[model samples]
Target: MTTETPVKTSNWNVPNALTTLRIVMVPFFGYALLHDGGDSIGWRITAYVLFALAMVTDKIDGDLARKHNLVTDFGKIADPIADKAITGMAFIGLSIVGSQSGEAWYVAGGEIWWWVTILVLVREWSVTLLRLSIMKDVVIPAAQLGKIKTTAQGVALGLLSLPLVADDNAWGDTGRVIFYVSQVILAVAVGLTLWSGYEFFRDAFRQKRAARA
Candidate 1:
């Protein structure tokens, strides 16, 4: 009698590969921005271009994973980590550049008076810690509002990386104004993110109680 080898069941297939690729792009994106040499149009354009490519990969990875039923433990965990890495790093990086270069900071329509970048970074880590605490028991599903909040954040981050100075001649003051608008949008997104985290905890606790009963 011949024995056959057993195959392991895994979500780590083609779709997951793509998701992993997207995660890998986060560091490359950061490097692109950090290495950009100047306030020149070409350099800024290159930075923005790389950022856009990374963002596109982010969307593609998720879509492919869901479409192909390739969602994995790795994908689920790593996807969010990639998102936080890219967005958080970009925001902090841009803020440092802005502060060092003396650029105005705005989120949506509001001005960020304090160290807004630091606040966002802290918030992301805090929320991640809370979610990890929940995950030790059961996986918390993403809320609809949380999805919207994330979309807003991606848009805001993309806009933040825009080379506003490149258009200073014609757009002049308009570019500065648009930058502030993007900032306000980000601030609002953060608020929504916090609210969704509260909901996640509330539901998780309820589930735990029900399980005990």
Candidate 2:
């Protein structure tokens, strides 16, 4: 009888490479944000562009993995870490920069609050830990609401990241208008973040109970 050789699979594939690239981009994105203290319009624009490119990689990597059956443990783990690092930096950086500026108002004629960032961080980290706790027992796939929350956060952060208008400039009025709209979107994202967190916990606990039964 002729012997058949088993197909060998490697973990280092296009999807994982892209995910690692995204992680590599995080420092560059942060540098672009902090290099000029986020005051220079050019640097701020560069940061936004880098962030957008990183976000694109997030989508492309996952799609490539699914299409090519190249998904791996490393990709699954690194992907979310990259996402949280990028998005978390965006929110924190925006809030810090806006706090420093005298004219960074949100929808309610107030500065972007740190509590918003804190709340989002708490939810994100808490859910992440929760997942790790149940990783072996249950697979908690991302829900549809989670996707919407990510999109909303991405758009809102993108708008907020741009340094298009100054308070005294002619474009200030337009920029304020856009800022208000972005804040509304951010609010929706925050709402979804909390809602999805609740769903995750609820499902996780229910699953645990069922498993114990």
Candidate 3:
């Protein structure tokens, strides 16, 4: 008699599955945000709720993968793709809407600035290309500043969503204050994101030099 080994099922990978869910939700979230009349606060609120849930899944998948040793290349690649899809779309859509409304320059414009959004997109896309060029074996772990940038982004986006809670008093002067604060936070976040990208490049260069030596 021979003992048979149980085959590990790929379906059992929770982290990769969660990341895939996030990717799938990105288009749907974008549609909801862009399709809605932009007048109803409910639509924005719904979009925000979906965005928040996606973010929660990000945290969960990372924690679970780390704790259970279930990390995989699929998870690594899909996670960032999901992030870019969601954030890039949100940043662009908000800015477009704000600009079209002709209130982008106003203090309560509710629009994301094009320059700020472009900066984020450039960083995300550049790093993504760099990672692909270098291959998966060359791991560039998230810097401390990167984590701070993520935190700041989450806070700012959340505050922006707050204005969608009601119609009349949904986001009065208080919400404007929060919006302004978030703008500052987002500006800082962008600065940190660039700094973190530079750090990654510097570390990568040093490693290459050492390898050549």
Candidate 4:
């Protein structure tokens, strides 16, 4: 009887390592944001730097995975988790700080409008669950609009993370402008997010119907 060769796996490769690094950075990023109640400019800067580094790792890891054929089940699962953790933390932290400080235009009556967070979370978690449910029979790849949404979210969060917007410094006006622009970008991201969620559900339904037929 001829022996069968074992299939090689690259789960422990550089791409996955970077993805793990991104996951590791999430707490540090949150700490920097929450340190001293997010009042210290130094802490905010540190948070922004950590966030940027984590975002960079996101890109590098995906590129490396695709380029070197290092993509694995672990990477596929962990990569999105890392992305959501970093970004979700950023959004929650920003909303909390905005509500407390009354500085963020997005906040009103000392409340950061729970609707925004609720909408985003609902879409994200629902789609993720739907994907998992159909994963055995269908593979739903990331769409172009989804990538745009991610980038917009990242840029908006990065802009909001900076201390300039909340400080009464020379750059305060600039910071305000950036903050407004970031809000616009965030709105676009939210729209795309909802649209993509609809598309995902639509496609899943169509596929299920087709398989039944």
Candidate 2 lDDT over 88-134, as tens digits, reads 88878777776776553542222357899999988998887778778
Clashes of each: 7, 0, 0, 0
User: How does model 4 fare in lDDT?
Assistant: 0.78
CA RMSD (A), model 1:
4.3
Ten contiguous residues minimizing lDDT sum, candidate 2: 102-111
For each candidate, give its TM-score against the true structure. Answer: 0.78, 0.88, 0.86, 0.89
- Number of clashes found in candidate 2: 0
- Residue range 85-187, candidate 4, lDDT tens digits: 8988887877777666755454321113457877887888788777777877877788887888889888878877877554446355666676678777888
Error of 4 at 83 (Å): 1.0
Better of 1 and 4 by lDDT: 4
Q: Which stretches of candidate 1 lie over 4 Å from their true place?
A: 1-12, 36-38, 106-114, 166-174
- Which wins on lDDT, candidate 1 or candidate 2? 2
lDDT of 3 by residue, 106-166 (tens): 4434568788889889988888777766654466788778778777776666556444323
Clash count (model 1, backbone only): 7
lDDT, candidate 1, 1-213, per-residue tens: 999986533865775676667667666666655553324445445656766776777788878877866677777677777778877767766765555555554321112334666776676777676676667576668789878988888777777666554424434678777776787788898788778767876887788787778
Candidate 2 collision pairs = none
lDDT winner among the candidates? Answer: 2
Give the Å shift of residue 38 in candidate 1: 6.3
